[model samples]
Target: MTPTSLELSTLGHRIRHQRVSHGLTLDELGERVGVAGSQLSLIENGKREPKLSLLQAIAAETGVQVTDLLSTEPPNRRAALEIELERAQHGSVFRQLGIAPVKVTKSMTDETIESLLGLHRELQRREREAIATPEEARRANTELRLKMRDVDNYLGDIEKLAEKQLKSAGHVSGALTHRTVSIMAEQLGFELIYVSDLPHSARSVTDLENGRIYLPPASIPGGHGLRSMALQAMAHRLLGHQRPTDYADFLQQRLEINYFAAACLMPETASVAFLAQAKKDRNLAVEDFRDAFGTTHESAGMRLTNLATRHLDIPLHFLRVDGSGAITRVYENDGLPLPMDVTGAVDGQIACRKWSARSAFDEQNRTTEHYQYTDTPAGTFWCSTQTGTTAEGEFSITVGVPFDDAKWFRGRETQKRATSTCPDESCCRRPSTDLAERWTGKAWPSARVHMQMFSPLPRGVFPGVDDNEVYEFLDRHM
Candidate 1:
């Protein structure tokens, strides 16, 4: 096989080392090997590849095997350091910094090279830590969402795995029962153990050695929350996940496990069948799907994004916005105009106040879903939003489709309509002319800054998880 650049560099170092050790000058070695001294210098400096015949001559003259001259191992510690420095200088990070490459010479001490390598390593560590920042995390999330949108957010392998597991548990199903969830866990060699004391940062913890899945004793009403947590824990094992090495890895693993859990909770075969029938009846609604599967409105809405485009040929969008109008989660393939930052990230950006997701928070009768037809710059889209509360705060879950596709949904005839000029400063970001004149320069309101804006992601083998707390909890349980 052709050697890599680094391997060839090491080979050159080995050849040079062997030649020097044998007390041969470059000119003498070049004459012995039937090559010019200039060419031999180039080979020794790793700038040229030597022929096998020339290598054999050098190996014979130097009293070493041909393999010795071709060995990838650096001949000495200094040579290894030099190779490392060269490799680091050639790296993208170093190149992006626009710094000139440091040239190593015989006069440069080994200590100086070690110091430079240490700085390079530190730079790499800092760069990795910077990726944990919220802006960087959002950028990564945005990219992942676009990729999911391209594939209609479907994972056939994961869907099949959920189906096989459900089949193994004898779940033919309306709503997946708690007992069935336990049976699935047991089949995977795990026992469901409910406990009062779980780590504050963790939802569920799995003891691989003891085959125990520890869960919170008190689950949310209707048991859907408990089932989801249990399924997510089992999914880590099912998906063969390793400890995340970085923020992006952590985000990916989190998405995969959640997808696995949703797939199990709302089995693909059953969900598609139910949706196909609903579309046939022209009664497609997120609440009906939620009730049918016994899942949260947000879960059902997201699950629809997974199936709607691929199975029903209907593109759509999903959104979860906090009461303050900031988007918490979003996915779109229907060309809805959602707010975004310069990085193309929608997370934490404020949704247009005129959109149903934000307006639903003000509805007097929030017991039912709010439906609206919004005319955006892109097109007119119909959305159904349901408002709910959690420990964190009030939020809205919405599922929407283009105006053309709204005919297949239940709330298509709703007379409520709105017009949004979003992404424009005048839309919702700016106050009315009179109000702006009245409040401008007179208001010095203190902004409520979220801690996440300034802080990096939690540091650990698992981000945001306290290892010591988990270990203590596990010890107490044992």
Candidate 2:
């Protein structure tokens, strides 16, 4: 530990007293300050000396001042250390959240510190980016959620087939969920804490104190939509969560993604290809949409929402549940009537109540109810809509295109749901079993594997070698 320059006075007494006032046990304080209980006990008992760094950490955690820890000198200096410590910790947390820091190094001179203070505005700008673009830094969010759902299903099978109930984890049930969320959270260098008081019926919570993310599973009318919805919820976690502060901008991003994903999967060429092969399709049947676009039903629905808005010829809006259970949709045709604020039982918000009304996979009892549409001063948005599912429904993807399209349904109806086909080398879903099979009985060549590896290994092929080819030649000959 780096030592601090804090002086000894009545500071040790003040530190121990402040720890108690803050409701932290000696061990708790020790953990926060990077001290052991025995060491803390000695410091508190005045049997051992106190270091400035320990005092700084304590003041930071307890909101006490280093000066207060020192002599009760001036009232202004009394809590200075605590304030500085807090400032440092907050910067660290923001960095954890993918925001840039105002300034990293310590500055002893007032002028240098003022220069650092000027960097605060830059920090704010970075924070704004993080808040505005939850979609950024989210390459695998959609895929990760889908894979986790598969993992969850695999776990469910194990849980069901086991002769005896697995030991109940009680409060630690969240631990099981944490394991799934942790992989991403760790990549982001964040800590996920389970908070019971989360505002919505989210599958998990994030930033309970500063940022609240809720994941509500979507419920389709019949049992048909449950698997898709559950998977969607997990995907929603990858998007990360926060209540949209700017609804219009947020909605715009939603619209853009809906459109982009659709365009990527069903380019004008692909659309033309479908038109040439089959004519007079209508309803944009989910299965047909998936196959036509080479994407999952959920992805197809997302594309439909954006595509319809962009082409007007398609004129459709769609809602689909991904593997994680989030009910995401892309909407088109602004003039149409739909309820925007049909949130929950609570007035004026997004909702998850319909899905919660029944178990996810209950197909027989699944049924559609009247959808509520609310007209807004700006336009129309969906209030609520319900659909039914078949008892043995496979994962369903639903697409709703305008009736004006000549062959929407016929082209869409006979199609089948498609599996994900996007290729990302770092994909967590790489077919390990397939790779193992492909390599069985074959001695994989190292040179071929090296060609596929990420370029610029940790060091050049050989350190201090200006030319890699030269080094390779020497290695081969020597």
Candidate 3:
């Protein structure tokens, strides 16, 4: 574009940005700059260009640098782009991305400028890739979790097939015994081996070439949980799921297989009836469900969500967060807003420290469940959480219901109450002044933030994470 044309747009953009950031109306800004509001509008809209002296006066009145309002350099492509990037970096909207401002200067080396340009190009490329940005990826996962949760964690087709298989195996009870699980494996002609010496990381690897499924001791040291390990392996064969093409598909298929395995262990019809009765005695506790069906508390909590949404007609929310307050799994149908990313998912996002889910880890009392009531801008919710130490260090499982819906829960009358404006100002992200003042020097938490931790890349990278292991496993299976 010509210098005159460029100057008009540049001056308008800078003036409008400075005015909006200062929260001044067109009339107020025009009055300060000694111009009529209508005339200022024409200039801001680029229909009229201001003289250099007038631009300098306007910049002075608006508390902006004169260089920002006028093209101090020629209107070349490189200069124009550098100016635009600088303008965006200074604007509130772009700064809100939480990125440190990288100031570009005419004195910078050509190599340094090229690097910055390369970074911008890479960011554009990321948009074409699936699930752009860490925030959006998190939101997408959260959305999927809730969508699967709403239907009571049931997949009709898969559940039907599972039910048929179990019924044929003469297994339709509270919990499918290990013996029954083993019997089904035998029926399928897959060799079952109980070895005392199995790799801790290897959870029943299926070898199609050898046709064998190996299991470790029922209870291994160092918190290697055995719950559903065999069933999860068996699910691979029963579900007949091939390798998924993309990460999202991989995630969905993995959860579906897990749900299918749970269906086999606690069959829908029986588990729902048990949960229904448990709710009747005003003892809708997840531990009761766990005891009645021989499932782990995490499994029990998920099962409760499934059966409750399907049979009890109660809308609920569930969350599983690790010790670092990272949300691993989350689902809600109660209309209470949870933290979400650009894609509208809450997974992999940090949970507020004051919320029941995150605070439950602080109690360190796994013997009894902790309950709290919190109010958000959207609505108030009553939540219950339990923390336990397992193979994966400490983790918390929490469930919540809306205030109106809390009446249906057992501990709705708990005197403990807290308010949360999560993912908003004045929440866990930015605590009260007193808290920071009190804990700032006393507490030394190493965030240890790593970029790789945010990646949704699949695990099972043993010894060396090169492609060799995957190739070997595929060859054996083939």
Q: In TM-score terms, which candidate is top?
A: 1
Alpha-carbon error at 468 in model 1, in Å? 1.3
Best by lDDT: 1
TM-score of each: 0.76, 0.28, 0.63
lDDT of 1: 0.90
Candidate 1 lDDT over residue span 360-435, tens digit each: 9999998899999999999999999999998899999999999999999999999999999989989888899999
lDDT of 3 by residue, 191-260 (tens): 6666664544455566666777767766565221343666677777777877544445556766776887
Backbone steric clashes in candidate 1, count: 0
Screening candidate 1 with a backbone cut-off below 3 angstroms (N, C-alpha, C), the clashing residue pairs are none
Give per-residue lDDT, candidate 2, residue 310: 34
Segments of candidate 3 deviating more than 4 angstroms: 1-143, 149-152, 196-202, 219-227, 431-447, 450-478
Model 2 per-residue lDDT tens digits across residues 320-383? 4333333433233433322232221111112122222112223343332222222223333332
